[model samples]
Target: MEILSFVAAIAVGFVILSWSADRLIEVASTLASRLGMSILTIGMTIVAFGTSAPELLVSSVAALDGSAGIAIGNALGSNIINIGLVLALCGVIYPLVVSRRIITRELPLLGLVVAFSLALMLDGDLSQTDGFILAGALVAYCYYLARHSGGDSEDDEEVVILSISTARAVVESLVLLALLMGSSKLLVWGASELARSFGISEVIIGLTVIAFGTSLPEMAAALASARKGLFDLVMATVIGSNIFNLLGVLAFPGILSGGLKIDSLVIQRDGLAMAGLTAALAIIVVSSLSMGNTDKASGSTLSLRRAACSYIPRYKSAILLACFAGYMTILGISALA
Candidate 1:
């Protein structure tokens, strides 16, 4: 049946995107380690930025194709999903204790970017000036991280050397990058085609279907990190990646938009959704931090038992399903309105 074929194509796209993202992360992590970058820097810069490649590719291509709604919707919707759907589930899976480092440094930066994004959207469009400001902010944020994150000291003997040779790392990074690009292309194309075939608007496709397709990497990474007991890393990936999505991925296409214009509905609906999600994430993080500090100050210790017991039984898949449902509802209302 045509339905079965469509489902099969979506399944294949998911597999390709998830697999490519894993390889890309692996290659990028190894490359950063080999180049003597701090793990924090690697996480914040390379891993965070690398995982956002899908968004970058999607938005850039959509902008070029004059599908500004697709470009903007994908970025805005993914920002919501990344924080709400990804980080919330990350916390639910394992109570993520917010590190002081993240709270003092990255959290503020994330908030700043979100504020900047909202200010731009209030003008009823993303002007070239807005794009320039965002891109400039991204550059400054990256520079701040590089300077304050402090590259690993030359004297730290505990730093592990990468097993892969430089040549191999280079080859792997390039190959994975190519594969990611190809898969993204296929995903964007198939998504548009499927939307047209189903008589769905491109905005709906971008908000629900395309956003999830592009978020395959974050889903895989979060699940993998959860399994490894690296809950903080999972949170970091989601939070940091969302920040990059707003500033880095959105800015590039916005700059190239000449003068971005769209329906106020984008800001009215998706913008509020994105803000609500980010706020939920902040509450979760802040709650966890408070709980963690109380325990630490009272000379209590944390264990897997406490974390596992404290989880409120929300899985990543559940969050994802709920997000999908919510997105569908939003689309339904938008289409009808």
Candidate 2:
């Protein structure tokens, strides 16, 4: 009965967290627009951070509760899910056009950030100094995005123009933010209890259940965008969210706990897996870009139709899906062992 209650609490917590995050993004975006920020700026900065709020809150709460495993697991696991699961599914549904900006700019930046994270964790813990470093990187990244808004004019025009008074927007944003934080605390507590009851490491629970729960919003958004044929948006969303998860979400736990101990399995398994996946994504994008250009130079009429078609073949998606499935299977076996 106790175990069941914890499971229920986790479920309810996830629901409330997801809802509050969505509302928070809406209110915050509206507020940003009213403050003279462009919609592209709002999308790149506010929306990106808003989507990652759940992970940030959950990891911070776990750190404060002294569950270093949960905090570290949530950060690394979410990055794995964002790329291995979420992005792969998006590709399967709609082969994403490898945007130059993503290949040349965002993907490399993600690689560098992940490398930096690995370097920090090499000493077996994420200290307060590491947290400050990551936090500073996040600020620089956000500032760069703000200064260079890449979204099309249509995206800018699609910004929700809220008629609410500035005072109301601020109040609503605060209320939703509070609710998000409270629900995240509830989630951490329940997830920890559930892990204890199951005789499983909190890291496993955090890597699988809690990671998936917090990633629900990203999955939903990716699916929705794919259906609309907005493949570029889907790619941007996943890449940007992963960056925030690594830098922003991971930093919070370090700051809250002063330092979080590294789980050996996390370093040997999850951390290496994340780096590999990020590298694979970069290779794919770069190769696709080169292929597209080569095909164009060769005067292939098919390549002239849509440049993306030359690069993202249907079989590539199948390969990505298979890789994700295999990774999940490994995790399941490890958990059982």
Candidate 3:
């Protein structure tokens, strides 16, 4: 009964989490638009940060609770899920077009960030110094993106600006943020209890259950974006979320706890898997760039015209799904052992 209660709590928490995140993004986007922010600015800062709020809150709470395993696991696991599961699934649904800017800038930045994170964790602990470094990188990356994002694109026109008053929007944003933080606490608590009941390590629970649950918002967004043929948005969201997870979400735990200890399995298994996935994404983007399928539309703006043959083929997406399956299999075996 106790286990069932925890399971139920997780389910409820996830539903609230997804709903609240979507609401937060909507209100925040509208607020940004009202404040005379460009669509690029809104997308890069408000929407990106809103989607990552759950992960950030959960990791912080876990760290405060002294569950370093869950804290670190949530961060690494979310990155893997974002790429391996979320983006791969998006590709399968509709082959994503690779943009030159994303390939030349964001992907490489992600690679370097992942490498930096791994180096920091090499000592089997994520110290406050490491946290500060990661956090600093996140801020720098966001600033770089803002400066280079260029003016509004065609997609920006599609954003629906809400007609609410500024004071109301501010109040709503605060309410949504409070709900998100509360739901995050419920998720972490439920996950920890569930792990205890099942005799599984908190890390495993974090990696599988909590990771998947927290990622529901991304999955929903990806699928919806794919259905609407907003492939670039889907790609941007995944890439942005992963970077935020590593640098922003992960940093909080280390900073709050002074130093969060990492399990060997986390570094050896999950860390390598994350790095490999990041590399694969980079390879995909770079290969697409070299295919001569893209065109320079304006200064610093490259337009990707979808060919009859997609740069990200369905077969490649299948392979990503296969990799995801293999990783899950390894995790299952380890949990049982």
Candidate 4:
């Protein structure tokens, strides 16, 4: 009976998490647009913010509770799951299309960020210095994006129009942010209790269950956007969510705990899998760009950039899902061992 209560808490937490995350994305995007930001980049910004909200809160809470495994696992595991499982499953259903901007711009940025994260963790210690570095990088990256990403509209669209009032958006953002934080705490507590009860290592529980739970928002957003023929949104959201996962979500343990010794398997098996999958995705995106049916749009590089686009076919989706299956098999075997 007591165990069932933990499970019930997790279930309830997930429900609130999904709803609150979705609302937060909407309000935040509206607020950004109201603040004169371009609509082109708002989806990536707010959707990632909304999806990563749970991971940030849950990991911070886990770290404060002295669960280092859950903290790191939730961050790296979500990156693996975001690419391998959630995005792969969506692509399998309806192959996603992305712009050349993603190929040349976003993909490289992601690689740079992932490499930085792994470099900091290579010594098996996530130091306070490393945490501060990542947080600072996140701020710098956002500023870069704000200045460069959609600057083509620098002339006419200086003041973007949004329907919502600034005051209302602020209130809604606060309320949704609070709900997301509360649900995250509930979910983490329940997951920790179950991990102890089942005699499962916190690392395994964090990798398998809690990672998937926090990723629920991403999965939901991807599927909905895919159904609406918004394949670009689907792809961008995945990349953005994973980026924030590494930066904001992963920083919690190092920041709050001052420093924590990384588990062996975390830096060995799981971290390797994450880095490999990330590299594979980048290769796939670039290859797709190279093969895209593009004609020269103009003499200018910027002209050609805006004109290039491609889609992930069902075959590519199948390949990604196969990789995902292989990864899960490894995790399952490790758990049993």
lDDT (0 to 1) per candidate: 0.66, 0.71, 0.73, 0.74
Model 4 C-alpha lDDT versus the unseen true structure: 0.74
Q: Per-residue lDDT for 31-51 in model 3, tens only?
A: 766776544345455555666
Please give, for residues 1-337, the per-residue lDDT of candidate 2 as tens digits. 8777777877887787667655655565577667666443443455456556778878898899998887888888888887878778877766666544555666788899999989999889899989989999999998888676644322334355567887998898767656655665576567667666778777888887778766655665555555544454566667778889888898988987898888777898889988988887777666666434333323444333244432455456566667767877888888889
Please identify model 2 stretches exceeding 4 Å from their true place. Answer: 1-43, 150-196, 290-311
In candidate 3, what residue range of length 10 has the lowest lDDT sum? Answer: 295-304
- TM-score to true structure, per model: 0.80, 0.77, 0.81, 0.82
Identify the superior model by TM-score, candidate 1 or candidate 3: 3
Positional deviation of 177 in candidate 2, in angstroms? 8.5
By lDDT: ranked, best first: 4, 3, 2, 1
On TM-score, the leading prediction is 4
Best by lDDT: 4
Q: How far is candidate 3 from the true structure (C-alpha RMSD, Å)?
A: 4.7
User: Cα miss at 8, model 2 (Å)?
Assistant: 7.0
Please give, for residues 231-309, the per-residue lDDT of candidate 1 as tens digits: 4446567767888888877888888877578668888888877776666555445544443323332245554323321
TM-score order of candidates, best first? 4, 3, 1, 2
